[model samples]
Target: MVNSVPDCDFTADYLTATEADNLLAHCLTALPWQQEDILLFGRTVAQPRLQVWMGEPDAVYRYSGTDFVPVPWDAQIRALCTRLARDCGTRFNSVLCNLYQHGQHSMGWHADDEPELGPEPVIASLSLGHARRFVLRPRAKGNPDRHEWSLGHGDLLVMRGQTQQHWLHGIPKTRRAVGPRVNLTFRRLLGAEVSAGRAESAEIDVG
Candidate 1:
């Protein structure tokens, strides 16, 4: 799928110095140190998030085939999750945070299309610190038109239903002098395989 692109929720919010600092403070204090993998290029990346599970207790995603255990919520984390959900006009009980220390850190192109997320999943994303470009390309089976946006500090990018299924998204590298950056995404998930015993699961194994 790479032909048509959806209407862009590709947006960013410029923050006053204080506002950016405040969010960064919460993320640093509240978020756990994330373990990450090198993307397509084998570069280092960090994603701190709670685990999420769907379907049967051992059920794994068709895409990543991962089973995870959720991280207990920190006070700041809970507050951020709640606020983001309210702002995006959606409800989310979990969040994934990515931390990039310098220009070299980045993520490869991919879609959050796992089955557990249910069809047409909703994502609420918040960015802090250095500004970075987030590129999105149509993956409509045979299309190639691409769209891009710069996610500035304190910016919020909300990806809605159909957004993930139709396209791939990623953070590209930059040569400009940029400080550390953090991103938070909130989403809700449920599936037939998930039961009370196996939730709070998340895994980031890219095939």
Candidate 2:
């Protein structure tokens, strides 16, 4: 099965454990990580985890009132991007990397449906480090169905089609003592003058 959520897929063994370990080490110390404070629930608060945005110079991304400029892609990252692009049959101009230090550092529910991302964007996520619970909830009312996945090291998950519009996904906090985990979400951003192409959507649009 591609995914528990419609229009998505998960590869449990995308990379070898040894390869994952090396990449984890390189990312942990090589990349410049930052924690940004964002407006949440009418109050500004620091994000629980550290993150970095890397991509093409023109690929600017903004979220929660914070505008992010792209950092030049590292050599290792560029290589991975090339491989993923070839494998997925799509180009990704940017990647948002999030480092979860422990179980307490988590991400809240959110979709990747940004204007710059255009409609029906394909997102590729690579997981490295400890295992954690990633949850997806159907946005349609009365369905009340939710799906959860245990994302571990060297795994890859792809979300495509109208999944973003119809589902909300996040990494919730856990009480268990867990090691650090890193997530790289690759996305293709549309230029200001560009228009989105037509594509099919999921059965529901919760928002």
Top TM-score: which candidate number? 2
- Those runs of model 1 whose alpha carbons end farther than 4 Å from true positions after fitting are 1-3, 14-17, 37-66, 191-207
Clashes of each: 23, 1
Name the top lDDT candidate. Answer: 2
Candidate 2 scores a C-alpha RMSD against the true structure in Å of 5.4
As a whole number from 0 to 100, the lDDT of residue 177 in candidate 2 is 94
Candidate 1: residue 130 Cα off by (Å) = 0.1
TM-score for each model: 0.73, 0.89
Tell me the deviation in Å of residue 79 in model 2. 0.7
Candidate 2: tens digits of C-alpha lDDT, residues 1-207 = 223465888999788988888889999999999997765545567888899999999887556656778889988888889988998899999899999998888887777877778779999999999998888887676767888789999999999998888888889888999999999999899872232222221111221
Model 1 over residues 158-199: C-alpha lDDT tens digits? Answer: 877687777778887677888888887777766534432222
Overall lDDT per candidate, in order of appearance: 0.62, 0.81
**Shift in Å, residue 109, candidate 2:** 0.6
